[model samples]
Target: MKFFQIRALAASVLLAGGLAAAHAQPAQPARTAVRGTIDQVSPTSVEVTARNGTKSTIALPADVRVAAVSIAKLTDIKPDSYVGTAAVPQADGTLKALEVHVFAASLRGMGEGFRPWEGADGKKGSMTNGTVGSVVTTSGTTMKVKYKEGEKTVVVPPDVPVVYLEPGDATLMKVGAPALIFAQKGDGGALKALNVIIGKDGTIPPM
Candidate 1:
């Protein structure tokens, strides 16, 4: 698949307690992506264990939102279809796809823009949201999507994970269920989930 070579801003990560001094330096943005199993959950927070064995606790604000993501196919992308692609910049100035997600029509205008993704591990990449203007299908798929800012070209390799979101309930956070969350480590060192993607049944979200 082919991808657009979208421009990017500098990527930085912020840690708690990095600005205690009067002469402190600039603080980085709090963007993170976490994928793991639900170790525990409560009214105030949830504990998750990463596949690599890293564990984190994230505070659940009163209005925490959740969604369910399911696998999609490359053919799922079509002209005028709303989608978002997360990809890393290649040395050749191309956006090499990390993953591709087709959006349900109801989410047409949600988080619609291209910018540095505050993904888990400070995902250093761009996320473009728009309607696919065209699709080139050969070995892989190349897509041209037009957003408010402009257009982006995204290449979707066959191996890239593709998913779409559906309404998810809090009960989807069953213990031992697979999940992924884009959150930020708050000042107190506990992560705060801004959005959550919970897997259904035994299916784990792959983006």
Candidate 2:
């Protein structure tokens, strides 16, 4: 299959309620996001060393999809774009965005909802994945995002890092490169990668 087809399949399968919204049923395999640096790479698998020095060797699928998480401007976020933002709650009840990631069209609505996230400021934050209903640019960039369950109002500051996914190839999987692998643990105690998000030009993916 082609890259776009594979990417669509990946969005439907890998992110099908696997991001902790509802509990997985008995048939769904447990999913995990592995953040680490590439230690080794081979035709079949790649070894990743985590920040704490733990290493994991995960097998790659035949058509492993790779996407480049490149930097974007705050203006890139507009109405109807599917986006995910990590933000901390302000005293006035609005969320302050720490980082914003614009999902590709194929992966839109993949993980649509709000959930708790570990903030960059060491405080408890929130992750909102939804469609932008509206955007206002007065004091700060404010967005009202709507999802299946509910909606959230987020204020994106000027200094927040914004990123978007673009088509990428295996050449980004070189040794010592940072990667975020979405994998499913097999019953045999091994992990198989569903897809990978790699940074472009040293811009690490925040989510």
> Tens-digit lDDT track for model 2 on 43-96?
889999865588999999879988888778888999999999878789998988
Q: By summed lDDT, which 10 consecutive residues of candidate 2 come out lowest? A: 1-10
lDDT of 2 at 111: 73
Off by over 4 Å in 1: 1-31, 89-94, 117-124
Superposition error at 184 for model 1 (Å): 3.6
Cα lDDT, model 2, residue 77 = 94
Displacement of the residue 76 alpha carbon in candidate 1, Å: 1.1
Candidate 1 per-residue lDDT over residues 75-125, each given as its tens digit: 999999888777777776667777777878877776677877645444577
What lDDT, from 0 to 1, does candidate 1 have? 0.75
